[model samples]
Target: RQIRSRFIDEVDSGVVRTETGATITQKADRFSLDESSSPKKSTSATSIEYDWETPVSGKTYKSASGSTIEYDLQDGDDPFQVGVIVEHAKFGPGKIISRTGLGMDAKVVVFFKSRGQKKLMLKAAPLQVIG
Candidate 1:
């Protein structure tokens, strides 16, 4: 007998598709050492595979002043400027509430419309500034 399962693991802008398969084999009753014993127990083994991908984070947004700005977050750069408008693929639009630390250790707190507040790492978070 065989069993299979599949699922998607998502974190910020990154996504992983996981698939797993298991196979089980039972011994015939005649092969059992004791004729009166229950059917021989079987062990099942599972194999798993994953496919990962990351989508683009944010886009260039134009403000009311007609000025264009780039809002995407990049590694080794400070992306969180307090009070800036930013958008997250999963959390929608939000505003930067506060920020702490520097470089890869930097963290930003954002308040979203649908998801409320969230704290994210600057380098790993899938966030983009809108204004």
Candidate 2:
């Protein structure tokens, strides 16, 4: 006596096998296939929002009547210029004492009242008018 083996492909069910004159069927799992299709990923959107207003020069920095912003602080060693007023969403209101960059791409070394002197990049566009 001789035994034969064969494999069969099932479209809806899965696969079928034949060994030693015996037939066996396998069922397909829907969840196992779908689990890999869905992926967990982080959203690429800005969560913080900022408001703009006129600055009162020597007045105390506050959220109201001024611009509010936030920074990722993810790029380079630092960003910001010293001796120049800058808008740091993370450090709030401050001035830049030095700058670092070549031509069009320069960052500021700002001295914030809250965070002291630190480096932060300057985002283009004016948020408020400071006297």
Which candidate comes out best when scored by TM-score? 1
Error of 2 at 77 (Å): 25
Q: Mind giving the per-residue lDDT tens digits that candidate 1 earns over 45-112?
A: 34333222332346565543454655465653444678889998779999999999754456899999
Regions of model 1 farther than 4 Å from truth:
1-79
Whole-model lDDT values for every prediction: 0.57, 0.41
Q: Model 2, 56: alpha-carbon shift in Å?
A: 33
Candidate 1 at 34: error in angstroms?
70
- Name the top lDDT candidate: 1
What's the alpha carbon RMSD for model 2? Answer: 21.7
**Model 2 C-alpha lDDT per residue in residues 28-129, reported as the tens digit of each score:** 432112222113221123533222222222222223335543443333323333344656555677776777662223555666789897754333423221
How displaced is residue 95 in candidate 1, in Å? 0.3
